[model samples]
Target: MKAENLAKILKNYTSGWVSISKNYKKVIASGRTLRVLLQKLEKMGNPDGYLMRAAKDYSGYVGV
Candidate 1:
């Protein structure tokens, strides 16, 4: 896809991560969020590596 389209998709993915993070914060207490985040990280192929790393870290902290 074009760079602009990729950027837009990444933006949406970031938003989804934010929402998922919020839910993980509220519901996961055993690192499940961390695991899920790590899984997402593994699936990441975008240039926004930092965001994915942040999400992974956050989820790791929550044990989810």
Candidate 2:
């Protein structure tokens, strides 16, 4: 898979909460690449968690 294609997929996935449903789970379980990416993202934290908060703050320049 190309970077552009992967980016497009991820962009689409991140567009809404419903995107993380069973279909997405099936996609992640379909192969190693997504599993590894999911692991890395987990290590970085996720799902309304700290890393997401930090990302929001960083992007919004709330406390630069």
Candidate 3:
């Protein structure tokens, strides 16, 4: 997925970590931190095109 699209998906979550699928149609995982979310996703065995982002603020957009 394009970085722009990834950023757009991330915008939906105000805080915490988010895991998005390749098609950007589903959420694979979510958590309070990148490490926690990564560990959770890892258990599912490295998803392709999956993207992770840490949202630190709710007032504006943030990137991974």
Highest TM-score scorer = 3
- Score residue 37 of candidate 1 by CA lDDT: 51
lDDT of 1 by residue, 1-64 (tens): 2211123223323222321222222211122354665565456532132222223223223222
Worst 10 residues of 3 by lDDT: 1-10
lDDT per residue as tens, model 2, 1-64: 2211123223333311221222223122111354454565566463331111111112333211
Query: Which residue pairs does candidate 1 place in steric collision?
Result: 31-63, 31-64, 32-63, 32-64, 33-64, 34-59, 34-64, 35-64
1-64 in candidate 3: lDDT tens per residue?
Answer: 3544444556567667777776777677887888888888889897865555556443464444
The order of the candidates by lDDT, greatest first, is: 3, 1, 2
The list of candidate 1 runs beyond 4 A from truth reads 1-32, 45-64
How much is the lDDT of residue 20 in candidate 2? 29
Error of 2 at 17 (Å): 19
Better of 1 and 2 by lDDT: 1
Q: Could you tell me every candidate's TM-score relative to the true structure? A: 0.23, 0.24, 0.58
Local lDDT at 62 for model 2: 28
- Candidate 3 error regions (>4 Å): 1-12, 54-64
